[model samples]
Target: MILKSPFPAANRFVTIQATMNKTNPSKKQVVVIGGGVIGVCTAYFLSKKGAAVTLIEQSSIACAASGKAGGFLALDWCDGGALSSLARTSFNLHRSLAQELNGKEAYGYRPLNTLSLSVTESENPSRGRKQTLPDWIDGPVKSQRTIGTTETTAQVHPQLFTRKLVETAVAEYGVKVVIGKVKSVETGGGKVTAVVDGGGVIDGDAVVLALGPWSSKFTLLSSVINVHGVKAHSLVLEPRDKDAISAHALFLSYQQAHGGQPMDPEIYPRPTGEVYVCGMSSQEDIPDDPEQIEPNPDSIRVLKRVAGTVSSHLGEQSQVKAEQACFLPCTDDNVPVIGEIPGMKGCYVATGHSCWGILNGPATGAAMAELVMDGCSAIVDLTRFSPARFVKRRR
Candidate 1:
């Protein structure tokens, strides 16, 4: 078949022909920077769409916030908002990806029942104390347990899931992985021509900036996209008896003895083993690279106090094995910045997923594939996620 450019007089046809015949005009390339969950998944779907994809990460793939996340997937968590629609679509895609990848071995996808409990632990005394406790929590609870059971609630080992997707993209779809710090995007005629990295310039017909928290840095260099980071803290715990915690996940509310404040701590029980996870101390405008984001002693104290409230339910002997902190890319309105980068031809941005990046990555990947390959998304409408929306709204 003779490949023809849309414009008959266009030189793209001659360029394509020359590349096919003898000269290697760099294969119609799509360079994706950042190998976190969003970047990896975007590259995977793009590769499946038959693009020559090169995913570049400065550090190891999945080494950033993607690996450090708590990995909870909840459909109703974003109920009755713009996020609700996207979350529903993404949840379905996550299930599909799990099935295709056999996530049991890597991501550990499993349904879970979630419960919210208010315990009488001294750490969270603001909830008011009562003599009788709920039979469920070993600690006497002043309030009744609010049981939330839904098949839609699920969890995955974030790093493993990202690794599996990247592996599948490379081994099954022929995507290439490159390790380098990208310097800038070379552009002319309002379109990206190549991406310059430490190794050298990597030419591409199209480029995608999926750099998560680092998206803002690239925008300063090339106006492709903008992103900021939201800091989060979490801790992994190994229950003294692992099996002492029940099959269901728990969210415990307690009062802080230090300031007499009330807070809720989430408990995530691993499906495969005795490890449990808790946390999330959050702060706005972290203003730091994800690599530099780490748990501080203050955040650790907050996590431990919250963990103590939940652990009291498991008989007060639970212990924390490790604590971690990382920044998740977030936008002004907290929705992902997806679709074309305004004013940048042949460039796309898919970052700022915030806390739900893992849960929503599959759907974002699929939507990205549609936008890049077919010029539109057939599933959830992406008009809300357009990178141009913010620019237009400001104007």
Candidate 2:
């Protein structure tokens, strides 16, 4: 049976011969210790460079934060910080990958207009005057302000994008995938030699810890990096009036008429005719297994209540699709750790992206591949995001 892709046909094909030529004739074996966007992209880039890569995952690909994240891409949002150059480079890479993979239809890749809304008592602030909101947003909206334009803001179906990246690496470049929990990293001569798991030991010339929050679980890495999980809850609603909802993404600060703490909610209308809403976050303990994660009941209740009030069509019980939650990997400084770990030769780390993992996955992958094969990244400078930075801070 021919499996049909739910995404649109991407007729473009990426050329990896040029990149493969840059690497030395001696092929190196790489082990990527996660299956999220970052890990998949890294594996893809490495395979494109003619390296033998083994992508190991504890669960299915993109089944964690990568699959559940809101794939909002911004070119200038991280400007003025250490992530500016990284963000800019990644944003541009996203557009290129979209075209290369025919992601425009395959993964719902497209530009979007983002808006900021302020809720008020009056349902129609203009007293039924002309408003620019989509017909489906028949809520008590007082005002809407443009936050991001199509020029800088864009979106992608995170799960599909991630899955496609891994699939391409395997189908086109023969990248192997190992499904099992990594028990430990075996080392000798101060370099990582192999990854030990339940099934057996897989040898590698180099290893990367891209295990998201689970990176903290391994004694080998937890002693060095300060990475933790921040739980976020979200809901996907298949509204009955999908056409009435435009392509605008909304960041709303809703003030309850009864006077209480204002709730900040983010709403994204996907090209696949589904609406995603998320906001509440907490410093919850990271679970042992990704499958064991669950959304807080109170959080889901609040989201459903507010979502219904904001868009009546979304409130219909029949339209409710998925209620889920995931953990975002974070660091003490809030910047991602994406470089070779000091003292541990041939060992690298690339997690702690927090909320921008999906946005920066491709660039991180490209940069990591360069670093692993060419001794340095040809793209953004990763000095500020080095794993050694955390060690330096401790002193």
Tens digits of lDDT, candidate 1, 1-395 = 12221112222111111111112244346778788998898889888887777777766678778887767788777887767877888887788888999978768877677666665555334344444333334543456454555576778888888988998887887776665566777666644544344235566677778888777666432253456776677777666665555556777765565546666667677765544554555655554345556687787777765666544533346566667877888888888888877767777888889889988888888888778777788876899899876777667
For candidate 1, the per-residue lDDT at 159 reads 82
> Against the unseen true structure, what C-alpha lDDT does each candidate score?
0.69, 0.81
* Residue-level lDDT for 145 in candidate 1: 55
- RMSD (CA, Å), candidate 1 to true, equals 8.1
Task: Tell me the deviation in Å of residue 335 in model 1.
Answer: 1.8
lDDT of 1 at 4: 29
- Clash totals for all models, in order? 6, 2
Q: Residue 377 error for model 2, in Å? A: 1.1
| True-vs-predicted CA distance for residue 14, candidate 2, Å | 32
Candidate 1's displacement at residue 232, Å, is 1.0
- Candidate 2 structure quality by residue, lDDT tens digits, 246-279: 8888888987667788888888889999988887
State the local distance difference test value for candidate 2. 0.81
